[model samples]
Target chain A: MSGRVDIIGLGPGAEDLRCPRAAGALAQATDLVGYVPYLERVAEDSGQRIHGSDNREEIQRARLALDLAIQGRRVAVVSSGDGGVFGMAAAVFEAMEQGDPRWRALEVAVHPGVSAVLAAAARLGAPFGNDFCVLSLSDNLKPWGVILNRLEAAACAGFAMAFYNPISKARPWQLGEALARLRRHLPGSVPVIFARAVSRPEEHVEITTLADARPEQADMRTLVMVGNAETRLIPRPGGEPWVYTPRRVGMNA
Target chain B: MSGRVDIIGLGPGAEDLRCPRAAGALAQATDLVGYVPYLERVAEDSGQRIHGSDNREEIQRARLALDLAIQGRRVAVVSSGDGGVFGMAAAVFEAMEQGDPRWRALEVAVHPGVSAVLAAAARLGAPFGNDFCVLSLSDNLKPWGVILNRLEAAACAGFAMAFYNPISKARPWQLGEALARLRRHLPGSVPVIFARAVSRPEEHVEITTLADARPEQADMRTLVMVGNAETRLIPRPGGEPWVYTPRRVGMNA
Candidate 1:
């Protein structure tokens, strides 16, 4: 009896943002595996065996989920945002490729969700209305120089950017350095948004300009977005301004 | 008695993929506004007054929704994917910025949804599991030279890319030209994905190499994804291979 493994995204910490397909997969799951916080988002009454692991143990967690599925268990691996974006979906595929050969026989599927970048962009109007790039600033898996190089390339290309894992205790200085480098390629007036825990109760979104943006404004929970050269802001009477990038780009621009 | 406008995403072509928050907004809407095809995605029984227009009439649609909302009608403007990403949200903000001053007083919100890129990536394993860029190949809104320049920058930066509006009747040659240019910077072995109408009944996903990809393989309904150098395919016995970009990038890479 072969079972299936479903990798699902919980969608930016909001229960309402979770799609029906993902919820259905969660309800039918015989076992749940994920980081402890994401696993806690699941209802406690489902009575599924939960395998919670540290945030850094993605490979181990993926292997465990695959092993369970190989043993005829319906397993679901969860991520906070879209699992396809810097999440467990890749790790599971990696494990299936390099680990137990039986893992390949078990059915595996990925369910998409509203990624943190989309969620944050929604809250900020439409800063990503045009072409954009999504990058993770965490250098734990890659070299820091590679991150800076990509940042410069995207910035010079005039693409809006969404950054994940922007700042943490281990890498507090990287964000500042990134911003410093961006200032050379982009105008100081370009809009930058720091959105934290979007769609959750503690959600806070701050819109600022590149000239005034500080590294301390963002934390590990934050998703940062920097606009392209054409990004604009529409002022409201008494509330924060709405930010958006116009759909059209001039021939010379 | 002022009513608000909610721009919501329908999430590709699947009802099951639509989030509860968007559904709730649809249920409460007194009026709906969208392009004709997306409006058809709504249940016929919703009984809301829908203002469906041509696909190119985004600004006019945004103005109409704002006008209805300003007249104390709860309006919901729908898009097939995330409203913030090349959808009605930017158009609405643009209209509000330049059309009517009363639009500034009316409450406007953008609800996030699973975008076409994310949905396509999910259906094909995790091709966007690492840093990636999203671009539109349509030159209707931007200059063709700008598109090619951005493509080159992203390719040189080693980003996996997702392309929207890859091919249409008016611009049949752009995709082929874009691929030819990419051949200059990227290896011919890079995997390219053509996912057409993902999550719908007639969904078809094709995986090919950069060397073998043809312009005829895609249409307006297709979302194209090209992997970075490190993207790998793991073959299954009787099924198509799983495509994923590992989370790690080496120092030299």
Candidate 2:
């Protein structure tokens, strides 16, 4: 029988944020395959064969994991956040759909970890406590039109919005354009959070209003959140501000 | 100095799925408080006082945890799934926003967990591998019209959607109306997944087309995912079907 394949999430850059299931899979794996940064997360002395590949080589890395599993090796494919969220899980399935027929017969399980969306929300209180939408602003994979449509829809619906891959060196204006679209529907006072390097030592969270939010404030490492109309900021005398979205809509209070 | 209050998630009903950060908080907690089902997840011999309250008592529970923390007891506020998403974190913030001024001076931290959205996505092979929206169909807090508007907006945006609190005995027809609304914007053939009790022993995942899906198929325990227009199903010879939303949108295949 072929050995099992476990696709695991390392969570969003924190050791303790990693779930036990993912950690156990890493400890038990005969081989580990992932992007370079995620691969660095595992201990070097674990005695497991590690294959670190370039970023965006998900399909190739997935195929490598599958081949190793077919040879009766316990293989773990690692992704930074939850493997299923624009991560290795979809790439593995895509490879399996188009790769060797035997790959389909192999055992596969995906162990989810804390996603960056959750990590950012946790750091900034409960900005995602109500209805919300998550979008990737980079147009590298999807058309700009598609991203714009989703942004407009989310903005019009007044859903709290989380943007992953908000800004990068290659696509700097996407965030500005997205915000411009949002500003068309949402009030200028809507709060926006720029949660950078969440849970890591260099973590920084900035709370700003939509009108004051600048695109340059976000980078590839940052996760940006735009509050719904109902979201609020509660000030503290001695600490950072807390942001939260109340559960109700259209209630007279 | 008053003790700290940590609002932590237990993840989606699995011990291993729980994040280590939350586990650490639980280990140090002088008191653990949450909804009855989640509070029961903790081991009885853990030496911490457990306060289990009836559902809908989130504010009361938050107050209790705060009161405990103010008394110099390290308190952990537990929630199933990520606490920031429709969970205890918001309630705690609400309590702190409206409660004692001394509560604002207490230390607080939110440990992210493996949410049901991620857990269900993992079990069903990455239905949320792209842009998506998460909405609660329960109209007890929000107006039904708000839910319908957001559902229509999400559907119109062509986003894969995860619906929490999809259906309950008190409001069974909401899911049907929701599905009917999605059918109007999306193709009848769009895929929908019902992930019930994900990551637990009673876990079950059902993949069905939107046209064939019925409201009765889901319950309060289910996390329902309605895939984007591009979501696909790959049939396997030896296992259940794999569902995935391709990473790209508006791509020529």
Candidate 3:
């Protein structure tokens, strides 16, 4: 039988949120490759060869998956959220472009999943109801200045924003700095959502504004969303106020 | 029993791409409401009262769903992709905020799905591997000037972009104008993907350069993706070349 590599997303921490196609891919795999925590999310009795590695070793993992697939192994590379969005799909393609020439001939397919931003936005009312931009606040892959420039551009353009990798052990100051920069472009009353461990048992969502948001509230597991000027906060009877950006932008806006 | 409304996404166009949570919501719904095409995608013999309307009647549909839920009906309002992203979720919240006061008390939930951009990117080897922005080309709700301003800002910020509603019978010239504007900031060699009805039987993905992309190549169902300067194209043996944007950006970029 010919080998193939299927890159699949497990969704954001919930079994029900994952696509059935991704689940089917897992069942058909001879090898499973991903970060340790993501690998642990799979069923233990899948009977596939499990290769779990550190989070920082994406390139190495991609190469290993490709090498295994070339050897006629049905490999499945997994990521926590949609593999196409800041996940393993890009790394696998990057590896194919830079690694062994035969790797390009291997059959590779990426299956979509419920992305982190979409899951976080669903928990909150619909902060991404209108046009929006998604950025990673982690400056490890890109420069700090680039992130700031993109933040100012998206904010000034009046687009709501979703941020991944907002805070980590090594980069705690960036989220605060990003919020400070956003305050310069957006109103103090504009809502900011801090969604941590969304869709999991430990899920927590907090709503604040640009003027009062703190970086300490978020960790690597958190996804942050900031609304545009037209975003509204509707007070409900007994729960958190629903937040959403209107679909229509008035002429004056 | 108290009433509730569940706004769920049907995903791009495939049954397998829809989340199990969304499927669960649909199964539990007593009334299904959405645009005619989206509502038709559900099982016809599900025994639920189906309320289908024209595509332009979003606010009316949302209000109807709210009214039904207020009468103690289990309502499911469906959108094509993730309901939070330019879908029915925002319209539902808007109706609640502006309509009946009791609507605020009704339990409402938004379930995430495979969004159009994510599904399109997955089909084309992760074109949105890095920071990206999603914009709608239709100017029906927002002014054309605002859309242009956003296009310029996102392009200058070096973001990969996904455009929804690129071409409709009412708005044909806007996409051409938008592409011309993008050409001013992005190099002609930048890859542009026109993905029509992604994940469906009629799915067609065309990869072209900014200089070669035409507005006529898209339709109401197409999702357009424009890569940043760093996006690359890798040639394989007998099929379309793989396209992706690298996760890392050099300091010079």
Candidate 4:
């Protein structure tokens, strides 16, 4: 807690695509801090890896990492996409604020990464055409009423949407409920694009009608994109557009 | 072109963040293609850079890039963020289809990058919380009516929105029109975020009410986020929390 916390952004999944800064940070670190899955993503484990786990364990792991760093160990806490953006950096800052004085005094810096939202958006041409807001479906901390209000607002606004933590182990039906609500406001033919495991293994994208998408299509790693009416599934007849979205909105209508 | 055509991505703005594969693709390119500013942002220039002076020139540059690649030269057409999101990759494809059949059979691979929309979204939390849409307010190629219709539909649906290419040198008042339209359906206090020059030298972020944001606050490089009513800006004494609109339809909200 005595030393600074350097939260490194390894960018997206591929090592060939990893930032040199993040790689250097890890190589120089005496300890690493991050969720277990993220650690598993990085195979070249040289430093003392901080075994952080599930949602509640981040604070404890961050404290331990800060404590180790306070003992003069170079520490690097990892996040899959960007260090910021609903990632560990937010929790790290929270811990530093609520924890010991030594931790508070430490200098912290966040390196930006290629967030999956941006990655998924790029896969689809101009998915975010104008004004759009992103909200997580996980109710673990947020209330559903608040989530529904925002979803309604977003649907009403017709912004290209990117959904994260959409379908989870326990929260299987949240995304479905969201779709049903959106259907009430938006034309059912809106192109809803699902980019599964973007930038990693099992990377796949599906352009389907908002009503046609099944919950099984999405998993923890999947990044779902529900396109606006203008976005169309450009079916390539013989060879499908690597990306798909119906060209016309409300074709189902 | 005897060599393969690699459409590389320059992740955001920093050099260290450049995907190693993207960098490698650029290094092997005999000719590089992109808009002027994008080319300048890339770290190293190993090949002849084909900078497009105008939008129409994008096709010309793509043609040259394809021609160079077809002539047995390694060609890498560059895009500032991701090559696919309003970048050269699409133009390159378009050019290939239009080119003489003798030259159309060459291999082309598009490498992805961190797109600006996602970077902006990550900075603002999940702006795509529910259903949303993105639009470029620039009237260069698209008519104002087209943009207006999308905006109208989006407003009625209550989608969070992200506005790119909002203000330019000539069309200074376009954003004002958008703001005015949004105000009709949205509360004046709705969060309107401005992400200026993201990941660039003069990068800055601000969250203001829809009506409070002055036209002078934006530029060509700025990304404007007008959140749905559900999108609330948590104001810190001097700083604003990057807004995240939680969906309120289910228990999680």
lDDT against the true structure, per candidate, is 0.92, 0.89, 0.93, 0.67
TM-score for chain A as predicted in candidate 4? 0.87
Superposition error at A161 for model 1 (Å): 0.4
Model 3, C-alpha of B239: deviation from truth (Å)? 0.7
Clashing pairs in 3: none
Chain A TM-score per model, please list them. 0.97, 0.96, 0.97, 0.87
lDDT digits (tens) for residues B132-217 of candidate 4: 55666776656677667667766655667778777887898899988888888888888888888676777898778887987778
Candidate closest to the true structure, highest DockQ: 3
The chain B TM-scores of all candidates, as shown, are 0.97, 0.97, 0.98, 0.89
Worst 10 residues of 3 chain B by lDDT: B244-253
CAPRI quality of model 3: high
| DockQ values of all predictions | 0.87, 0.84, 0.89, 0.25
Ranking by TM-score: 3, 1, 2, 4
> Candidate 1 or 2, higher lDDT?
1
- Where model 1 places Cα greater than 4 Å from the true spot, the runs are A251-253, B251-253
Q: Name the candidate, 1 or 4, with the larger lDDT value.
A: 1
What is the interface root-mean-square deviation of candidate 3? 0.8
Per-residue lDDT for A92-178 in model 1, tens only? 998898999888878998999999999999999999999999999999999999899999999998899999999999998999999
Docking class of 4: acceptable
| Fnat, 2 decimals, each candidate | 0.93, 0.87, 0.93, 0.21
The order of the candidates by DockQ, greatest first, is: 3, 1, 2, 4
TM-scores for candidates 1 onward, in order: 0.98, 0.97, 0.98, 0.75
